[model samples]
Target: MNSLALKGNPGDGERMAIMSGRHQAFGLWGLLLLIVMAHGCAPGGSTEVGPRAPVPPVSAVGLAPDEPLRVVATTSIVADVVRNVGGDAIALTQLMPLGADPHAFESTPQDAGVISDAHVVFINGVGLEVFMDRLLASAGGNTPVVTVSDGIRLLAFAGEHADDEALADEDHGEDDPHVWFDPNNVKVWVANIESALSELDPDRATTYRENAQAYLAELDALDGWIREAVTVIPEDRRGLVIDHSVFTYFAHAYGFEQVGTITTGGSTLSQPSAREMAALQEAIVDHGVRAIFVSTTVNPRMAEQLARDTGIQVVPIYTGSLSDASGPAGTYLAFMRYDVGRIVEALR
Candidate 1:
């Protein structure tokens, strides 16, 4: 992955000169450089010479006539949100593949290429993308990286999650990154995405705003549906036992307590000690948690073992990434519905 910064105000002649020099030094690699350079030279391309420029609104940036804005999202879930806002106005690429765990995802060279060519990048930022710093370093460019969770109230790690070794190892501070668990929070994401997309392609500002408004309505409906579905389960039985602290936002929003987890942290990469497992099992039995919700992105062996020991069912849920096109939880809306329905079925 090339780590060259591509955000300068170079004229076309200077760009051609740079491309020619690159071609002489590196063969086909220079062609890739040229493509990236061409993207940077597009309308709204960074024109600053030294220090990074303040992030400009999409309206401030100019796009070439008929040129689609180039965008990149760190995960499938984020990609879907951007897709809803940008619609066909932007060429978007998802860095993480479907079903990839965002917590532990490492960007490939191809991903770096995509990021390098992007005019803007969207992420679920609350320390969720552990590889983000390194990935950004590798895909060095002045592409504005937007954190969709920017203004949403963040939930701090508490209770049993406070002592998690993985959270400590990753230095995730106190805030949880699984904000998408609540549709209301995703509404915040939709607004941020629309704002960024409009800033990048102001000509499509109306279109982006319209798309965001429609998606926000869908998210509102999803929130109400989740509330209604959750009510079927008795309040006392609304405890959630999961593979990780992935449901903190969901539990908070839908009036459920996150009783315990197979792993001790917010990330699936965390492993539980024997003491942790014993404690989790005890909590499961004591709290009468009927199901252990396991994420499709993580190995379910530990969760299955816990369920077997506790005599409870192991329910699979989508987290970190969306299901493939042929799967039930393919889109963000479908993913939430599927997971909420599963939760209702398990405890109701």
Candidate 2:
């Protein structure tokens, strides 16, 4: 009966304390079966998927009038977006704690309880929540799960090494899941969130649309700011090497080349082997990469070691999670601004 407690900000109208219980073996088996089934039905079943039509807005016939719509978001970033759109109209709960890694987050019984009582569960949903299947099964509910990344075109893993071909293919043979690296993709997320929330609670439809529009304008300004900020770095110096492959979308949008990563594939859970490490170090030296960008959610030991070996600097950036309430990256907008400033400074 292991217990996990996550503290929320009282000022933000968030739950102050959440208690989650460990899952039993039966639930684990059910989760595994669900994953297997999803994998079997996936297009190409470990290969790239072609472009598809944009995800249609979700519509609801009616809403419960007893109280606000009970909404659950899997990650803080997702929760923040929902908060912006839903405002004071919805009862939203974020599942993951501050700075928790979504890729490796294991759900407890309390998390299940929260999910079971929710009207809708929102997730980043490009394989970002690796434990989501188990969490949903443990919760045992028919709550609609909404994926915020539904409409964006996904990027595949880049620069695969010969030694890591199998691992890369097995782990990330499909599109990369870190779409939020580009602010434009987040615009898509906002649209999805606004539509979902409006549908669930139709009475607040006007408010949701208004809030979403305001946020979209902010996102537009953010995209412009990133472009201007990136112009400080020279074209040749715009090479990025990070802890993991998290910047594909960012690089694509900003005209930077992804030199390499400390860990292979998209997920931080995958480890870099000796040969892979050696290869990355060599590439860094060859490309004259100035610094290695690491995520706050992941351990910096390996990145630090690589920096020591190559005589480069190690800069920590927020990746999978946001910072604590008082930190620099407490919000998604702040997170991107801080990270981009760090990246431009390091590269320039």
Candidate 3:
């Protein structure tokens, strides 16, 4: 069409210009609206998801005939319990390497691949696996996960600032994750593992049950042994000073008091302030703590310094991960035995 003629009243021309400008503005706004709608096609047409939601727990599904149930465990400790229950019926992959600190674990692309291929993943869940959310996202977010510590009650961090039960958060972030320190908790782990395996491979349910029963018996025996062994330490001298709050369950189960921790909180990822260190040193002297128990996975620089400052020994224990099969703490059972024996010797 020909352009509209401008030979009109001046006022009329000005009005037409205003109308044309309005049309252009409306066109721009319409284009922007379409772009926003395109991007906002998520549920409820909301574009922003804010923070990522935690990976939800998935249920295990039974495998086909004679097919091995593929399993991935977050740590070597968790893998050992699953190994005890699943036996030879499942193909297991442990994500964190041996002796790696679980609180500071970083997942790799290969770990994501291993997780993605698994039928079920086992974890010592109470905010223990810090890399789990991103790792699960990388693994397509659909892998079944069994938290071995599900049924057992979690102990919260008895920080200097708060009481134990008072520190329990809605997310249980302050709760302790080192439940395997107590053999009874490991019995719960064995039961959870057996149930998950039985659901995943029902044909071998009998075998899983049998293995779980045997392991439970072993755990009971270990529990009895720990009770008897801790008796060697005089009641008045049973105070524990550790690198961090990793031994709450151990203390609670074995009648020892966690006199002090170098780190201020449950996580070793946290740093101890100068004030906190001074206070811990004072507590050590006040409580007559004999040694500073440190985890093999954690750096002993601070613990060594603390030991020097306090004139006590630094006892290295396995907390986060297990050692190789040839090592002293290769298995969970052996790990507890080694740690307890060291604790007894240090405190007795």
Top lDDT prediction, candidate number = 2
Off by over 4 Å in 1: 1-59, 158-173
- Model 3, range 200-304, lDDT digits (tens) per residue? 677898999999999999999999999999988999898888876777898898888887776655556555445555666677888888899998887787788
Per residue, candidate 2 scores C-alpha lDDT tens digits across 159-200 of 424124444344324467788999999999898888878776
Q: How close is candidate 2 to the true structure, as a TM-score?
A: 0.80
In candidate 1, position 71 carries an lDDT of 89
Better of 1 and 2 by lDDT: 2
Runs in model 2 deviating more than 4 A are 1-66, 159-173
**TM-score head-to-head 1 vs 3, winner:** 3
Please report how far candidate 3 places residue 220 from its true position, in Å.
0.3
Tens-digit lDDT track of model 1 for 1-348: 111122222111011000011112323233433333211113232212333334322334667889999989888999998999889988988888998877656678877778778888887877677566556667774566787887889886433545555445654445667899999999998988887777667888899999999999999999998988888899899889888778889999989999887654445544454555666677788888899998998777777767887899999999889999799999999999999999998999
- Give candidates' CA RMSD values in order: 15.1, 12.5, 20.6
Candidate 2 at 129: error in angstroms?
0.2
TM-score between candidate 1 and the true structure: 0.80
